[model samples]
Target: MPPIIDPTKCTGCGVCVDVCSEDVFFGSKKGKVPVVTYPEFCVHFNCCAYECPEEGAIKVRIPLPLQLLYKGGDR
Candidate 1:
């Protein structure tokens, strides 16, 4: 799933944007919360959440199919 940014916690530091390999986020340099432009491009790498300085600022939800694939099991 795509990362969801908490506007309240996001300081618009652009760390999430800079760390994302899929270019999922976009925003201005004037401290605006980055927007998720392409969710399908996200590979669930968790880089955005990992790089976010604010706790709970970015949340990444892996889809059920992807979760099963990663877990090596069937539901």
Candidate 2:
């Protein structure tokens, strides 16, 4: 799964671009918001979301095939 960035919430801080090891995100040279340029490169580690300073700025949805592999737990 790839990281989905919310333009409204993103501050274009470049943190996500900096933190992504897979080079999935691309930050604009003109200081515009970054984009997920390579979705297939994403490993679904969610480093982008965790690095985002703005809440709800990045949403990483697990792929349906992978989602079925892990069972939910009730705490």
Candidate 3:
């Protein structure tokens, strides 16, 4: 699934954009917000989610099959 952005909680510090090696997001200079520029490369890595300082700024959903494997601590 795609990475979810919660505008209310997003401080838009661009941390996620900077941390993402895949270039999945872009920072907006006019506003304190980051936009999801490339949704397809997300890969449900959830790195952005964890990197976000806001409690729930980014939420990435992994597919069921992969979720199961991830749940087993493989990922």
lDDT for residue 21 in candidate 3, whole number 0-100: 81
Query: Whole-model Cα lDDT per candidate?
Result: 0.81, 0.78, 0.74
Residue pairs in clash, model 2? none
The list of candidate 1 runs beyond 4 A from truth reads: 26-30, 69-75
What TM-score goes with each of the models?
A: 0.78, 0.78, 0.71
Q: Per-residue CA lDDT of candidate 2, range 1-75, in tens?
A: 468878888887888888888878754432568877878778888788887889998889887766655568855
Q: What lDDT does candidate 2 reach at residue 23?
A: 79
The candidate, 2 or 3, that scores higher on lDDT is: 2
**Pairs with backbone N, CA or C atoms under 3 Å apart (clashes), candidate 3:** none
The residue pairs that clash in candidate 1, if any, are none
Cα lDDT for residue 64, candidate 3: 57
Model 3 over residues 1-75: C-alpha lDDT tens digits? 468778888887787887888877754442467777777777777788888888988788765566553345443
TM-score of 1: 0.78
Worst 10 residues of 2 by lDDT: 23-32
